[model samples]
Target: MSDTAPADWDPRSPKVLDNQIQAYDEMRHRCPVAYSDYLLWSLFRHEDVMRALTDHETFSNGASRHLSIPNAMDPPEHTPYRRIVEKYFTQEHIDEFEPVCRANTEALFDDLPPEGDIEVMSALAQPFAVRNQCAFMGWPDSLREPLRQWIGKNHRATRAGDRQAMSKIALEFDGYISEQLILRREAGEEAPPDATTRLLHEKVEGRWLSDEEIVSIIRNWTVGELGTIAASVGILIHYLAAHPELQEALRQGHENLPEAIDEILRIHAPLISNRRITTRAVTIGGREIPAGERLSVIWASANRDEDVFGDPDEFQPQRNRDNNLLYGAGLHVCPGAPLARLELQVFMETLLAKVRHIELSPDTTPERAQFPASGFASLPVRVQRG
Candidate 1:
């Protein structure tokens, strides 16, 4: 029989879910490594998460039962697929995608009202994510609405920990991606030249990637770009709206946008956590666990670690950038970091270009997103256009 530690904290408690970041902040100070039935074992400190990240042998990424392509694979298998993914996110591709990303951002801005209060999620953040992903993948505009709805269903299922619902939601998204693959294959040379079509030609270990593999790749991209991007947009804007001096400084000098974006996200993570599992028995933050138990690497907590960042909320982009696990570290560092950076930089630039000021709406306070996700659920804000 395997040794199992008693529960250290309840992840499903109403308090934790109600305000995830604050709860994580408390947990990081109180019990760096905590256990709950839902998460099994959760590493809340920067040191613990980094150890799990850098040492892949002891801390494995093959935690998901579903096929996760490169992200879910280890070493020998993970290497080649990761190489393929890296190619798509190269600076060249990022440069090529900039104009399209900019045009999409501009079009979305046109829909925003010139001066009054706005529900940024529906008005801007959510739609921007859907459009950016669809445009980059060469998906049709018709898909924008369905994909938006899919993100809602996906988040609801994830938060509920409903495996059955999660499986169905995954399939529902797979079907959407599968149809695109089919269309590209049917069109042959006439198919739209986009990321989705390009993946059809990706080779792994001298063998063409299978349909299932391609879907998994796109699924990773959609989840990365849509949900996280939406959350990020809200977080970035919210941070700026709350800090007028910082917002004005950013507006005055557009060059500081990228570092500023990373720093803000470090304060409020767009992604709450990622999963890992122990290949063998190990101890983390003095908590013991047996082999094969799952672990939750809580990014939200790790990034804000007081030991690393001093004052977790203090904005120190240059000092904290090296330690920020925003994209992660080691073997599984996000391959799409370049693309994510470019998307965010352009988004901030476009907004700051036309909007003279951004302030939180006094009419309705922003609603915090629940566990499994971060950032505001509904952000009502006032933006003054120049």
Candidate 2:
């Protein structure tokens, strides 16, 4: 193990944080495997990130101090938990939840002003994510506000790298889920038949899942659903607003929504990066990373690699579909992708069908979210009714 690698970049610097995608693009070309204090060995190139993902033996996912279900687990141990997570995102489950997702999206769309300036993040993106998550999990409407606030706090703690605040925020989230579990336990047979209740009855390796495990699973789902989903909505809308031709194309017939959403997100990633720890000393992009070293696979950059895609910003869904790492790759790929895809597809379809045109707000510029988060923090747009 060598600790001789000097810092090549600062991930938290104003220049990088102000425009993460551009900074990552520059990093991928300049230093594919750059070392930084905040992210350690950051893998920016597509090839390097893919290698870490595929070679889980050399690059492990057990990078978190806290138990993160299958997200932070590696192999043999990761398989069963991953299987359990996959079950909830099956075609059958996603199909069943489609109507609920559409209804929630439609309800949110109905609340948008008929024709005027509006903030996409608040007016549509955040509420749509929160409502869909609550509806899917069988959580109450009351949780909508709390979860929204909790996600903001979680992002703030993460960006600040405040371990105590992060831990405290995590406990607060667990408390929210714990109350739901307690309610179901007290309800006995009358307990709501929701995902949360179903989780209580899930058996892993012949034993009922512990409260801690259940809370962890639910926490993972909640975080992914709230953060990524919200960020994605903003990105999708902002991209369309900026490109009226593509916006009109989709608005005419959104049958191409699934493919289009994937492509757009590839250009402007919603999820910035995922963490991994080296299990053995390995040389990647000519840099030697020792065993147990922490690394970040920058999806925000890798997906937009010019080597993989001729023009990183070009809108070519069919061309880029094969190599798109929007949901990631390898064994630890996102388990909730099916549900996420379905929700985004439905939301986009509804948005296009309802609003005739979506344009950037005349006076306000969209505010980009900082590290540990991606997409816009605030997206101001003007909507014209059909």
Candidate 3:
């Protein structure tokens, strides 16, 4: 299906597809506000990206151009749903999730076959990342495979722009959540101190949420987290293996693991681009963007803008500035960022503590996922005991 991208679609090149940050930087400098027949206008500058995000009213989130969320809805209506989810993704909840995530990471690492080929994506990153979400939501372990498959189908549907497929999978996941809600209701209790419970109990639009809204909220979490986290972790692990010095540095200062994780995330910026429908005609970066048309703000590109970051391509874990749009910006910035940070920190700390060495397999190359989500299908590598 469309493996060869249009010439103007910069990041779609085979080489750049694998290394999105590099490709995004190259395109930003050459065509900051580029146009493709398919994706309309793409904005790449950091300041421009910031402006678009902050001006939420003009770039309304409920444009029906994309799926549900505060990501797709403006303020007033957006704020309440965001607040409901924000409470669950708070610093306290993230801290609570740390131990379980760490344990899972370590267990997966321990189980990897040593001194031979192992596809880290399947054996470690993919499963561990999804299971981490299950742990966070307190979902039954029985639902893991089904949820993972749902995630895959949902991702595929989104890329294909198949609304019917999206609705189908949405209902499938929603049905599962509905059953869970039934079980929780039978117990006549709130959610078990996790996102699900918070969704079940919280009010969205001046009243408690319905089962559909709760399921949609969980869908947002799974879509926002699962694949992107897995991809970022896979890429981070590959980098760590290639750069043993960095891995050693991280191992020595486990305290700086969080900082290290942030920097790595900044470098990779898992999800490639976010789409926003322009409410009014706006001229940005010398390009005229029309109202009601969609524009993509490339987070990967903005993170590497020379204006925002010096030597932008280099990986410097201790960079003190917020130059990256990895977590996005302004009104629609990712609310689940704190939880994501916690997961990354715990995973890195546990992985470093458990493994003596990590090396890429000779015949292995990661296969990047389709658009919306930038990640790998398989990341094969080898692990040595600590």
RMSD of each: 1.2, 1.1, 3.4
Clashing pairs in 3: 61-72, 61-73, 62-72, 62-73, 191-197
Give candidate 1's error at residue 132 in angstroms: 0.6
Local lDDT at 376 for model 1: 88
Q: After superposing candidate 3, which stretches have Cα over 4 Å from the reference?
A: 1-19, 65-67, 190-193
Question: How are the candidates ranked when ordered by lDDT, highest leading?
Answer: 2, 1, 3
Tell me the tens digit of each residue's lDDT in model 3 across 274-349. 8777888888888766677677888777777777677775777666346567787787788888888878777787
Give the lDDT of residue 373 in candidate 1: 74
lDDT, residue 99, model 1: 100
Candidate 1 lDDT by residue in tens digits, 13-131 = 99998889999999998989988878888999999999999999999999998999788999998999998888888888889999999999998887777899999999999998999
- The segments of candidate 1 whose C-alpha lies over 4 angstroms from its true place after superposition are 1-4
Considering every candidate listed, which one attains the maximal lDDT? Answer: 2
